[model samples]
Target: MPNAPAADQRRLLDVQALDTRLDQLAHRRRTLPELARIAELESQLADLHTALVTSQTAVADLRRELAKAEADVQQVRDRAARNQARLDAGQGSAKDLQALQHELESLAKRQGDLEEVELEVMERLEAHEAALAEVTAAHTQLVDGKVQVESERDAAFAQIDAEVAGVQSERATAAAGLDAGLTALYDRLRGQLGGQGAAALRGRRCEGCRLELNPLDLDAIKAKPEDAVVRCEECGRILVLLPEDH
Candidate 1:
């Protein structure tokens, strides 16, 4: 029902093209591969960190166990040594000497048992330490990988953002000074019609919906003045009638 210069109606196609490109750019930003990859890497890093912490805790507990085992062995050994020295001085009765000898035997056996416990704890501590070292190294490698991927992701973001900026500027220029009513109608239709407000009528086809206009509709559209605005019956989009060379 509105009117615009024939040239302005055709220029609206260029504006539509720019808008479509902008939409594509926005979709590209949302579906960037780096975003998914980064999320995956972060999840792996979180699991690896938990494993590393668990390994470290096991090593710490083993170390404490080894220390207590060593203290127990040393205490038994010190007591046996003092008992031997007193027995050698021969300053007590036979009963006392006999009792001291029996006690020496008990102390020697206690020392042997304690030494076995110490050795077992030492072996366990060594194994846990080795496991901790392996986990630490793996965690460090994962962290490095995450950092590298993050850098790549940032570079990708910068590139896409720059392209979006360029496309937006072009769109602004293309839409500038367009017929106010036409532009307003186009925007409202675009909001309702999946980002396409206008499309060309090539032959009988409405490019917006990819459907052919009926002969009656096509004839009616063709009868309109060159400056008269028309909409496609199939899609409800402004139909720009470009001049056919043939």
Candidate 2:
């Protein structure tokens, strides 16, 4: 492809500037404050959910235990009632009566032990449920906060997108002056070189690489016509020569 005119070649610098602005806008969008806040909140929400699940499980287990303990007490109480009915009828021998009395006492003791277990389980379940409620409420708060943060993040992205659109329009205007082949080369090189394809030759140094050009290469570059676009030896970016460049 033919080289672009000397004046049009400098237009490439304007295009490069616009591209850099676009890159900065993208960076700003990614680093928005809401992005970090959302990330931190998401992590906290996960932990809270885990805690809620654990508390719920404990409460369920304790409920089952309480139910079983209450059932055991009821069974023992029923047996003691039947024994009392037999004693009230007074139809048993003295030996039988004494044995029945001993059995009733044993049943009473077992019932007391079971009732104690039932009360302990009830207290534990109540505490576990209360803890679960607290965690759930906390989780709800975080969820709401995340929603707000996401909304703010979207607004930030929209702002950056608008700026990007404006910069892209400017880039198009700058690119229009260059030959198709020149812009194509620049785009390809920009992709390969971290969003940069050109830099001005400032004094005796290649600004793209911040390197002082060797004497032989520098002399050869100086000998080229003003319209001749050159590539930097150190970094291979299109080297733009300003009028004051030596």
The number of the candidate with the highest lDDT is 1
In Å, residue 101's CA in model 1 sits off its true spot by 3.4
Per-candidate clash tally: 0, 0
Name the lDDT value of residue 179 in candidate 2: 74
lDDT for model 1, please.
0.87
Clashing pairs in 1: none
Instruction: List, residue by residue over 95-115, the lDDT tens digit for candidate 1.
Output: 988898999999999999989
lDDT (Cα, tens digit) per residue for candidate 2, span 1-246 = 246666666788888889989989988988899999999999999999899888888888888888888888899999999998997787699889888899989988888888888888888888888998998899999999999999999998898998899999988878875877778888888999999998888877887789999888988988888778789988989888877763
TM-score of 2: 0.79
RMSD in Å for model 1: 2.4
Please report, in order, the local distance difference test score of every candidate based on alpha carbons. 0.87, 0.86
Q: Assess candidate 2 and give its lDDT.
A: 0.86
